[model samples]
Target: MDGGQAMIALGIGLTSAVDGAAIAALVRRALAHAGLEASVLAVPDWRADLPAVAAAARLLGLPVAPVSRAAMQTVEAAVATRAPESLARYGVGSVAEAAALVAAGRGARLLVARLAEAGATCAVAEGEGP
Candidate 1:
């Protein structure tokens, strides 16, 4: 499939209620750096406050994919970066990385690892689409 046909999932982790503009800016930069367009925004299901992420996805015209904590944990072993605090609190070393991988489905690989800005984090994962 062509590059346009490929889907890239963006996983976001937030510590606070960030503004949609901030999240969108970060996602845009991260995606530009990776030379990929995001097909969807993925967030941890346990996170109740998701207005920022939801708004960002709407701003970017992409769908939101809520990944379960179990699914995110399952991909933790494959994550390259390790966040001790995150692991202690959420049982996942890198929530963004893990969430991206899980939301992208099987065989998905990280296109851009966690990129942090203020209270938010972003990661991108690429997967094949049928």
Candidate 2:
């Protein structure tokens, strides 16, 4: 699946989450482990963090999506990894997983659960394409 399309959710905040070193590194680590490529990044709060989010997308050579709190919330039940902090703060289990699902659009499903290190996380999801 090296060339196949996939949606990747990235933890994106300056201090809150990031397109930071740890999280960005995990994007490759997680996708490589799962045999996927990064075609899109589902940044959960890209609207409020546009520049960083855009920079991350440009750096990764992929598109970035804005995943709203409500959109992520819609996929809470679909996440495999549960972060207590995320649950309390965002009403979702895993921000990465939820963002991935939301970015993947309707009929999306998680292809990989949340992967974390250094307070950052990543997840992958795919949709039933047209």
TM-score of 2: 0.79
Best by lDDT: 1
Candidate 1 Cα misplacement greater than 4 A, ranges:
1-4
Candidates in order have lDDT scores of: 0.82, 0.69
lDDT of 1 by residue, 1-130 (tens): 3444666889888865688888889899899999887888888886635677768877999877888888888888778779999999888888888888887775788989999997888999987632
Could you tell me how far off, in angstroms, the CA of residue 15 lies in candidate 1 after the best superposition? 1.9
lDDT of 2 by residue, 6-123 (tens): 4444433233544444556777787788787766777777444655456656667776677789988988888888779889988988888888888776677888887777656678
Question: Ten-residue segment with the worst summed lDDT in candidate 2?
Answer: 6-15
Residue 101 displacement in candidate 2 (angstroms): 0.5
Tell me the deviation in Å of residue 45 in model 1.
1.1
What is the TM-score of each predicted model, taking all chains together?
A: 0.90, 0.79
